[model samples]
Target: MGKNTQDGTPGSWFKITIPCGGKYDKTWLVNSIQNHCSVPFTPVDFHYVKNQARFFVQDAGIASALKDVSYKICDEENQKISIFVNPSNVPYSVRYKLEPEEMEQLKLTMNKRYDVFQQALDLQRLRFDPDLVDHDIDIILNRRNCMAATLQIIEENFRELLSLNLSNNKLYGLDGLSDIIQMVPTVKILNLSNNELNLVWELNKIKGLNLEELWLEGNPLCDTFPDQSTYISAIKDCFPKLLRLDGQELSPPVTVDIDTPYLIKPCKESYKGSETLKSLVLQFLQEYYLTYDSGDRQGLLGAYHHEACFSLTIPFNPEDLAPSSLCEYSKESRNMKKLKDPYLWVQLLKHTKRDIVCALGVLPKTQHDLSSFVVDMWFQTEMMLCFSVNGVFKEVEGRSQGSVRAFTRTFIVTPASNSSICIVNDELFVRDATPSETQNAFSIQVPTPISSSMSILSQEQQEMVQSFSTQSGMKLEWSQKCLQDNEWNYTRAGQVFTMLKNEGKIPEEAFKQIP
Candidate 1:
């Protein structure tokens, strides 16, 4: 069959014949042509008939060159089989295929349009290039495939392209421009004005560019917005670093220097009250938590005032780090901001020491980390003292057992009978522990118990006492006595040592190591 070229001239057709019974395909023939011929050309309308393949070429020079080359196709036998490329009787037409000559013309045209000093390639109105017009090759950027080919050429040759002007290209969509970032990621300025782009979303296809300047004033998408500011705002959302849009200067983007080091004040307890009040609060916390973490919740009955009120709050939206099961506390969480129902609020709150202790018993058994405590004295007066303790705790035995939690507990205490203070009001807030909090919780080494004739103590119990003594700088006898007084609990033992040490109540001999 005969086909005509773009200029109404008959294209040159050639038939390639290989050795009969030889194992060969069209790809083998194409590779052979590329290997043998010095000039580059694509086989248009390629098809096979038996053991022969016929193809058309628009460029007469490439067709003549192909005929002169001694093409050889190697078969399974490793024999050099001669392949013949002879002019065919049938004529063929070249539709969209660009021959070697036309490709060269396109490259020459691009070279003329490129500014080497500025590293900019101006491809606007590419279809009107006089050089490409003679070869009947119209470079249309609107065609995705055509645009891709053009970009491939630019990426191979002008790799350092920093600015590209693709204006007046009649581009309606940016699908062809999606890979522009990968091709030239450093490109800072882009001109896409005078195009047919009508939707703001089309720009999303090229969102990753670190473009500092963009030109889209003449596009239909610009007209869709109500005003210039709206257009600028919509475009700026796609490119945060854009400093100029359509020749207008935009405000420089506000960016944080993430690389700069920031000074984080060390975490420590804050006490705004007098030293006497501070010591009192510390002692009270040490005693209260020791009993609270014990097996018996009823032991805390005297710690609370007769009419003490207790309530618990948790975050409304828990994070992924939260324990998988929060059923233990979620049902009782009385966050006043989230739980607006006044009746439920009154029902969840515990009034009086007995009610508070019962409510605490229903919750999980816990082991509080004394070292993680960060106490803050909020207010103090002759009548009452208010303070808050933030710390981490582990659920020792429950449905959420082994999971760590961070909590903040606030207390309002007043002097009770016998010169003792009791909690008049208590509020507890719980949340998932942060990564650092979980790591730092209970990290301190407990003192190790000294070898003695405490035959009843288990090996684990001895180790706990020894660790506590080592950590508290107390002799083994005093450390064991302290741990025994606190039910052999390391956390409670350490807390008692700290309170006694701060109050000057510990004897000087207690700090001495065992012989």
Candidate 2:
């Protein structure tokens, strides 16, 4: 009974009917589709009726594919139930549109539900309302059409609406709930208890609502979590401002108020030592990051002491909004506060240069934004150097490709043979970059190199070539050639040098100092 277009393609919407006997829930249907269907598809919206389910896909090809494999899916009794993939005869807008008389009746019903003094609308058990039942009208909040119409009426009449209770409404999906955040912006207390909502991700539909109280008790999603603490944690992830949940008063959220007035001086990037020591630290960082960002991490074996120590740490809260993906490094994280086992503490630490380099090889390829780097020297002595560099970097390849992350790297180094410094201890902490950081990342322009006469260059340009040589660990001749190739632009020259170095195109003598 499925309808086809003039070209014999199936319609975008299809309904599947099965005999009402066994408990065929939404989770079962989703699993069956994922397991049996050969073609991969994501439904835009799904609705469940008493003995039928409707699926709205993006195109007709997916509809045809679903129809072809519909019979392959079996029920709890292992029997292939008959299915009718028919195009919804009525267009969605026409189906949900209310008649003039019906609109007036709905308005009247909503007026009865609204409490003007309390500024609350109690729409629980709306389908069973006596007035609606008398008028033979059924308003199911789970259906997108009904919810949209209800919110439209509330927006027009109740501009000051503060609280909304939508409990026991057989609601499984909140497709139209985001409108409340805009239409009823003042509404802070929401009650969605005793609903059929299952997946925790469904809460993402209304994630930005500034609600102080939320009630989601008696929902299927609550039981799916391992324990009550986990349930609360998951809910808090969605609603960080929630103070009360399901009749339980939660602890106040901890947050930093960056705008608070302060009398003390602000922290500025500083190196308390002399300029000579500062220059050494800068040169070291410039060389180390250049090698670290290169394709072959084995090249860094000489940068670390034979008995150096290295460890990585991540935020303890897995749901922290920062880093997009942490699974790649979470297992090896040596967070001292959370990791209490001494055995694990020793095992996670990389002790030798070989082990450290090997471990670094497994990390995703990265391109650091050197322009965004801020360094501060913590301690300086004849025996050792201690400092930290904070900056933004992009993952160029691997599971978290293209993700921008903020990182702080602390290094403890000591003088080694031949005037080189080697890392004695290193610690790296990574988190999600702030909005400003992500926006300004990699914004520095790189100019193309063009041949120009040295006589025409400015004093600043000549000085830049000398500085690039020291910072890049490249011979003066090679540094000058790189700058000239990049039109005498210092940033462009550095970027080109790094690219050539990573690709193994630069000669070894280019990085060595000329006699």
Q: Rate the local accuracy (lDDT) of all candidates.
A: 0.70, 0.71
Summarize candidate 1's per-residue lDDT along 1-515 as a digit string, tens digits. Answer: 11233543443555555445223444455677678877998665444444444555556677667766653445566766565666654432234445566667778899999999999999999988888777778778766446766777788889988899999989887755766767777788999999898888777667778888999978878878665545665676678678788887765421112121221112245733355555666667776776677755555666777689999988875345654456688889997776879999999999876678778877888878776788997676666778899999889886678789999999887666446666789999988899999876654334355565466789998888678867888767777777766656566566656754764767776677456
Residue ranges of candidate 2 with Cα displaced over 4 Å: 1-90, 256-515
Worst 10 residues of 2 by lDDT: 255-264
Best by lDDT: 2
| Model 2, span 1-515: residue lDDT tens | 11222222435455544444223544456558757666787543344444455545545566676677756877767887444555654434234565656667888998999999999999999989998889877777766767877888999998898899999998887756755766778888899999999987778657767788999998999899765555665676667677789998765421112121321122344733355565666666766776777755555666778789999987786466665377677778898877989999889999877667767777778988766789997776666778899999888888688788999999897766545667889999988788999877765333334456445667887788779978988866677777765457576577867765775667676676567
Which stretches of model 1 miss by more than 4 angstroms? 1-97, 256-515
Q: For model 2, state the Cα shift of residue 176 in Å.
A: 2.9
Looking at model 2, the pairs that clash are 322-432, 323-432, 449-485, 449-486, 449-487
